[model samples]
Target: MLDRPTFTISNVRSGDVVSYPLVLFDGQLHGASAATSVTVSRIGADHPRLRAHTYTAPSQAWPVALDTGVFKALAFLVPGENVIEFRAGAEPVAAIHRLVVHYLNAPWDYCVRAVYVVPADDPVGGFQAPPHERCDIDSAVHRLALAMRLLQSALAELMHRHGLGRYTFCLEEPAQARACPSEGGYEEVLVAYGVPVHVHRFKHSRAALQALSGDELYGRVGQALSGAPDRESRIDVALMSFTRKDAHTGMLYGHTALGGGRLALFGSGSMFSWPENLEQVPRRFTDRTAVDGRRFLDDSAGRGEYWALASTSMGAVLHELGHCLSLPHPHNGGGIMARGFDYLYRLFGVAEPQPGAEMQAPDEPRLDRSAATRLRFHSYLIRAGSEPHPATLYPPHPPPAPDGAVSVPVPSPSPTPTPPRPRLYVATNGLPARARAHHEAHSAPRRPSITWQSEGVVRVSAPNGLGHIGYYLNGDVAAHEEFFQASAPVHLLDIPWREVCRQCGNPPAGAKIRISCVDHAGQIEEAFERQVGDRP
Candidate 1:
């Protein structure tokens, strides 16, 4: 019998940090006469979870062929250490190769000092339950703990996608509220339908809580904790929880500084409504299992109203923390940073029939490639002991040419304005009717339609000096190709459609495709097209 094809992992080894979204696995399937299949799976505790299943044609299976076989896996690694296994065939045709992925710098660590703010009259500050009777602060502490856990999980997933590991969040002992004078006295509001003002004061009042800007609060906390000898061991994150909204903006969530040391504030009222029965709060909040070293709170339980509340509250907390980590809101679409539960559903890849459930949480939130890249860059700076600056991370767009620098056009001396260099066009197949209609409706006349196949192959013929070719989906660069010398025809056949769809907001069927080319002189040319395909 002919020898079974031999498969090996060529590009990555046991410990390697691959880029986010796309991880290329280069290997040869020897002695294969026809197309063969390969499987890439993430090693899990119970079983191997399939990540990608792609086939290679005969012409591309051998190393001697013009196009060597390479499998691209879309990785969404969790933070810390993640293991992925590769195999060739449905039944172990090749020895499994294991890869360890890390999402953060190995020695990076930070501690979060949680401060629970309560009314001055309250005897004991911070989170404390009564000896026998239920306490009012039970729900606040429960939600805060749950939110922190979710935030850690989301950050881990973001780091994992980029292949860094060992990022941790240590929750320190809760700090007591600092006594501050009440602002403007209390304004009585009606409670329980219509009640006497005197009685309403006992139940609820619109008394403003003393407010301090995030910067001011951070300084105060830093001074209060200055006595600790291990101050330099880890970065400080002051997680201040309050009973009322910020007096200045009425905003309940905000943070100051990102990386190094920072302060994140949360208003309990903004997180969740108080439960009528304090017993409703999950006992797991205080469970030993909830606090796992640098990792805290567990999302193991799949049921209960408190879980849903915790999940929703956690979303808010995670969103604010994202800011502290230098992540911006992708306001254009749904994600943790976007508005509403739509982002949560999309993150977990679930549809909620009953949107009112108090215990719904995303399985794991995901970061787009751009956001992931930004976070990785900031994390690197933090590990290197530098404060992150927006200008340093993302340079400002070039300013328009100054008026003095603009040269007046001397009417081209040639009577015939040098025949406009023949309009360059990128050749591709025609778009489907639906895609064509969508393009015609949304695109401008300057953008031309180019045809492309489902395999992500695009043909281009350009003048000499072509330095690079870029393929974009919905404005985001999806693939890049570099050329040493200009050639008659060039093809970009490695655009990972799965990742492209993801970056393009995972359109239902039709998506906008654009091709941009930059010549050696830096002159840029582009063509736009649309395609309809099954969801990636």
Candidate 2:
């Protein structure tokens, strides 16, 4: 019997622009007594063999030999789309694999302008400086300086993570006394009703923003920064530090007018302030310490109220900026664009829960495959000469699914088709009593359930033959299992909970576990389970 030849490619992905010294290894030369031949060909109108390499075993044993090869230069790839194929040996017995390469043009430069806003009556008093910089006189100046410093540092961190190292932002000198004008008669009605008001606050509304032209908003950013219109590509963000709450909660946080020349309004109160009590912060936000032990400029030891506040602010800005860049909040629980701020705080390692806290640790933040693909698509659009509108870059969110439903599967046409739904279960001894109580209280029939045990283990059983099974924890692919036989038994997979958690960044209160399975004929099904319990 002839063994099948196998090989592996290293350090390059499909469509990636590769550099020199391509590493290829783990070649098994099958059914060869002597040296085996391999040819590299560029597939096109005229298929040309780029080069030939030989595989020889250190000491030949029997029917197979192991070897490695390297390609020094990839001069064969042309400007646009190119296909590279590797064939081992000749004719029908040869093992062949192909890779497609898209040699891309230079990436586009996306720019963002961060404008700091202060109250008109007290232009400098909204921000607070460091202890050493604090002065009894000119407190406003100190406040403005502190606010500017915090925002700058936060923006820097934000850019490094989401910008893919290509986006840049400029911090303009603080925009002072630039209050949004209120409607003449509306202010009188609010005053008659005894509604509290702040004179320097901008009216955070779409209609209010639409009433002013781009030039009027640009003017508020100060004369030195008024040239942004000349740089039509820039995303203008006004960071307002306000003491009074807006009538609407959404307005208090901030608002963006994507149609209004890529402009966004962000309130510092929600973004920069941390709750006085550590317990008040979500468990996920304060569960993990920073991996690098890096602290912010204002944070001395790197894990406390100051660090939490700074890190949270950075995450909030990143989230709002993501919207500014035309990206929407993802359905998954990971990444800056997700529903909660806890993941962001955990991603930066700025906070962790005090010992013996009841709350589950925050799920760590990650740029999953979907988010990366969306970003890449946006980049491609920018590179293809599409006018960049930082606000409307991505498509809007699809309508929500039925309550408690994760996802619905597309219809299938196969006879003897596999079930369209898959079931998942978890057994963990590490779940806290309170968490268990919460889970049991909210448990529903047919819904995914968590069971208590002495050890943590996840068991996945499929009635239909399992062709491919993938395990995802907290939105990242953790592990996968495959069955190649055409007629395999009902597949049962048992995975250690510790192993799954380890692959998912060790979220303390357990991680969100998602399992996707494909049947023998390629019918796909998915199930989601949130593993809530004490850390094992």
> For every candidate structure, what is the RMSD over all alpha carbons to the true structure, in angstroms?
21.5, 21.8
lDDT of 2 by residue, 460-519 (tens): 554434445555666555555544323444456666766656655566565576655554
Residue 503 error, candidate 2, Å: 27
Q: lDDT tens digits, residues 1-536, model 1? A: 34555555543455543212123344555544343444555555342322221111111111122134443332335433457665554343353456775432212223443434444344332332222323344444444443443344445444444443312243432221112222422212111101011100111121323344655545544454444323433233333333333445544432232222344444343333222222222222211222121112122233233334344444555565555544445525445554332233222212232355523644334554444434432321121111132123212222222421111111111111222121121110022222322332223432222334566644443342344555566654554455532333233224455554554556666666566554322234565455648432
C-alpha lDDT values of all predictions:
0.36, 0.37
